[model samples]
Target: MDEMTCPKCGSSMTSRTLGAVTVNRCPSCSGVFLDRADLADLVEAENDWHRHTGPLTEPLPRITADMTAPPPSRPKARSYIETLFD
Candidate 1:
């Protein structure tokens, strides 16, 4: 197939194949061109991945006030020379 030009930026697009699907991506603008078939294939692949990795059983820990609080600043230790002067 001929190399595609990005419709958004008019930049030269590179062809990348994921499994049997071929997608045109613009290096300049990071835009991807996907037809219906390509989109369907990608969606199917994502569904398969989700199916293999089961949903999380436990809820993730929520951020609390303590967790968000800034850590207490410690006093700077005096250097050996400063201590000798003291």
Candidate 2:
């Protein structure tokens, strides 16, 4: 495939395939780009994942002042580009 340049940063972008869909991603800014067919494929892939994984959240625990838990430490947030390929 020919190298594609990022429209936002002018850096070279890399191609990644998720199932039958191929997307271009910018390494510098973590941007994702997809064509119409790829977008449709990605949407279908997301729906399939949701059908298998069910809801992503769990039931909230009982809330009380004394029982309050410390704020959960967050990991570095991943971009949608990273998520789509994973």
Which candidate number maximizes lDDT?
A: 2
Model 1: per-residue lDDT, tens digit, 5-67? 999999999876767677777889988787999888777776666566654599867887677
TM-score of each: 0.60, 0.60
State residue 37's C-alpha deviation in candidate 2, in Å: 0.8
Q: Can you tell me which runs of candidate 1 are displaced by over 4 Å?
A: 55-86
For each candidate, the alpha-carbon lDDT, in order, equals 0.69, 0.76
* Model 1: per-residue Cα lDDT at residue 84: 18
RMSD values, in order shown: 19.4, 5.7
